[model samples]
Target: MKQVDLGGSGLNASAVALGVMRINGLDSDAAAQQVLETAAGNGINFFDNADVYGDGECEKRFGHALKQSNLQRDHIFVQTKVGIRDHAYDFSKQYLLDAVDHSLQRLGLDYVDSLLLHRPDALIEPEQVADAFNTLQNAGKVRQFGVSNMNPNQVELLQHSVQQKLIVNQLQFGIKHTGPIDAGIHVNMSDPRSVDHDGGIIEYSRLHNMTIQAWSPFQYGFFEGVFIDNPKFKQLNDELQKLADKYHVTKNGIAVAWILRHPANMQVILGSMNQGRIAQMAAGANVQLTHQEWYDVYLAAGNNLP
Candidate 1:
């Protein structure tokens, strides 16, 4: 696996991050451990988790697996999110403090390598969030801090209060979910792609050296379904197959490679639970697509130019 610096934060991990949001479905601790081993063997040292995933069951299973495996706590990178709640979002100081403690308990670790604010809280107090982060850092609870599903303005607003650099902003980005890319290319145009959906977040993140961890890389329309093999995405799949054959990788692998080809420098968070698919996608990180090939797949995803 290719190693990349995470948001110029001096934290480095594989280009691919194995998200454990779905691991709560594993039958046993051993099964969970098997998943960990497979991901680790493929050079994926970074594992992504969230407090609300499976209502915290996913974190519990991940902790159990880590405890049972031979892998040490310090060798791999563990990052988890906080702030999502039952009916709403909470970034209150007390809530964040308690959440980190609970997450550490579930992961059986003293601290997470990185902690992300899961989603933007409409009532977020930057100073309160900063206080929580400073307290956690002083207590050795969280090593680094970041945000998820946040736009440039939101990130800038929050970063204004925190001492730690907001290093990562995980967003929904891929061949199909190209809102961030669309708004950039269609500049000064009248089409929907020029809507500036995210406040030019792609350029914003790149300017700040913030790593954009792309979640749901294979899905379309906000997790409606994966377009990898869906008949509705026949043209896209056909192009993916063509690239896959050209690169000697699977169609999914081509998708992963396509993401890695971007100069914006993103981290791909894979959601698949299949062991073979995980390894195969990780292999794609090693691939570097040409300029023309990259745009070819982009157009194949049904995008239009101005």
Candidate 2:
């Protein structure tokens, strides 16, 4: 459980944070409390949730579980997303403000540690969003702000009109899906591999001091089944297992280590509802995979070295 500064914010967050998306299905309140206790015991102080996850059930569960726990509110960093409703994205000033308020009520909190725009809204007006963010910041509703599933240009658009700095960009990253790394390695050629798929998000985030949080660290893609132990990803899993054995850790931890090995200072968001799974993944923050082992896992994932 290594702690890292979340962008320029004074608050320090764990390198591996807990994602509460799947906690809505927990059979009992005690079950959810056990998960939270396990995560906190491992020094994971950052808890991520969203207004739309399980239709806001997850957020309410977290708020209740925290209240029952002995842990104080200030000891944790809680983040939730906005701008998404039903099936559409909404970043309009009115929607953004209303969304935060709803999230606050559901979570039973005065202010969110950080509020992120869930995704890019095609009709986004940066100035309108800035006004909402400014008002929220002044009213002590939100301490900081950021975006999720957005590329460089989308972030730049917000920066153009917003006075507050964009401090974090949460993206989907895993060993099986390495498009961000692949696009960078194959840049600038007539070949399709050279095309930028992410709009140079990785570099832009690094350049702007925006922390990149890796969500779904084990998924094949977009909530698809995890690649761990899947026959389709046998080679990659083989290498991961070998490294896990070397480090005396579980294979899941090795999967997390692959992302932690990156120099981007990325944080891993684990969406598991199982407490044991979260503990296994948290161990990766302490296991520094060797340089060779890191690149070996990369090649196993079928990415070209160039």
Candidate 3:
């Protein structure tokens, strides 16, 4: 697929990323290898992972699969997140340092292309985080840094001290979950869609040139389930099918295309472990939906323009 500048970091990455959160569920290392190879063959060079995914089992599996696939380290960009502990968020300097080392060991790599704070820690000390980042960068353990599930203010709080530019903010975004888009469109309105839940993070990211990585692009209601063929989203599925037929792609491809149609230039993280499904979703990068078609799909997802 298509490559874009990740924020303004000068790092060119695929518009679609293979999220390895669920790779641990695969039946064998060869299966995981196939999934990763299929994605790379389709031009997906970005891989998203987290220290806590499958309790770190996913990262271990991915490392093994990568070794088996014979893919060079420089060919792909690997990113993982930290800061999430067993029950609380920890961004302490020591924790951040240890977390990157653990992730590196698990991934069988010298350093990650990027490291992110999985979630904001309410008791975060920006100075300590900055120190940790400095140590990591100075030691060549992490090339870039970012945050996830954070509002604009929280990003600002950390940016004030961290020397590296926070280049990404991963968020849960899909056709059915359009809080960021809703707040922008419904500006100055008295409707519920006008409520600013993310502290104008969408606008902030755009303004600051931070890439918003859209995670779980097919799921609705926070992992309640995928809405692609669910009866509850009949209207959405019907519209997706109509576009899929027009584009000669599967409904999943249409779902991915709808996310890429946005002007934000955000990366859609695909969490599928199926090799065939991975290829199908990656094809979405080639389908450019018309503006009307994009809006049609959006509205079909139970959202109103207001």
Per lDDT, the best of the predicted structures is: 3
Put down candidate 3 lDDT per residue, 119-153, tens digits, no spaces.
99999999999999999999999999999999999
> What TM-score, over all chains together, does every model reach?
0.98, 0.97, 0.98
Question: Once superposed on the true structure, which residue ranges of model 1 sit more than 4 Å away at CA?
Answer: none
- Model 2: per-residue Cα lDDT over 1-306, one tens digit each: 777788878768999999999888998767888889899998899999999998989889888888888678889999999988877898899999998999999889999999899989999988899999999999999998999999988898888999988899999998877878778888665566677789888888788889999998898877789988889988988998899999999889998888988888898999998878888999989999889998899899776676
lDDT of 1 by residue, 57-157 (tens): 99999999999987778789999999998889999999999999999998888999999999899999999999999999999999999999998889999
Q: Looking at model 1, which ten-residue stretch has the lowest summed lDDT?
A: 66-75
Model 2: per-residue Cα lDDT at residue 246: 91
lDDT of each: 0.92, 0.88, 0.93
For model 2, state the Cα shift of residue 30 in Å: 1.6
Candidate no. 1 TM-score: 0.98
Candidate 2 or 1, higher lDDT: 1
